[model samples]
Target: MHVEWRGRIVVDPELHHGEPCIRRTRIPVSVIISSLADGISEEELLEQYPKLTREDIRAALAYGAELLQPKSI
Candidate 1:
């Protein structure tokens, strides 16, 4: 499925010691991804963390994919 992944994902040595986060929020994308990896469903995620949205989750995935992507030399 086509997903809209925005630039909300951010990483900086000054922020969270360089861990990937959801830009404005200190919530790490890795945390969200890990939760899902541990079998946390989308609906459960939203319900558990009312502060997160579907888009946020998608952005995290996109950010992770970008990190793993091999850069063209």
Candidate 2:
């Protein structure tokens, strides 16, 4: 299944060298994803990045998952 990433997730040349990131912040989506991979819970994520919401993290993960999918020929 493919998830449509919208809102907080955005890609901008000025942000993280064009890496996907939270729309208004310099934080890269990879940082969020890696934290989750390392067993950081949503609450911990929120605690670390006070401005980040659960939805933002979910969107980042969905975007990452979409990137990992095989492209159809």
Best by lDDT: 2
lDDT of each: 0.83, 0.85
RMSD of each: 2.0, 1.8
Task: Report model 1's TM-score to 2 decimal places.
Answer: 0.78
Q: Could you tell me the lDDT of residue 32 within candidate 1?
A: 90
Query: What local lDDT score does residue 62 receive in model 1, on the 0 to 100 scale?
Result: 81
- Tens-digit per-residue lDDT, 1-73, candidate 2: 5456787788888778899898777778999999989998989989988888777888899989888989999
Candidate 1: residue pairs that collide:
none
What lDDT score goes with residue 18 in model 2?
Answer: 90
Model 2: CA > 4 A from native: 1-3
TM-score of each: 0.78, 0.87
Residue 33, model 2: lDDT of: 95
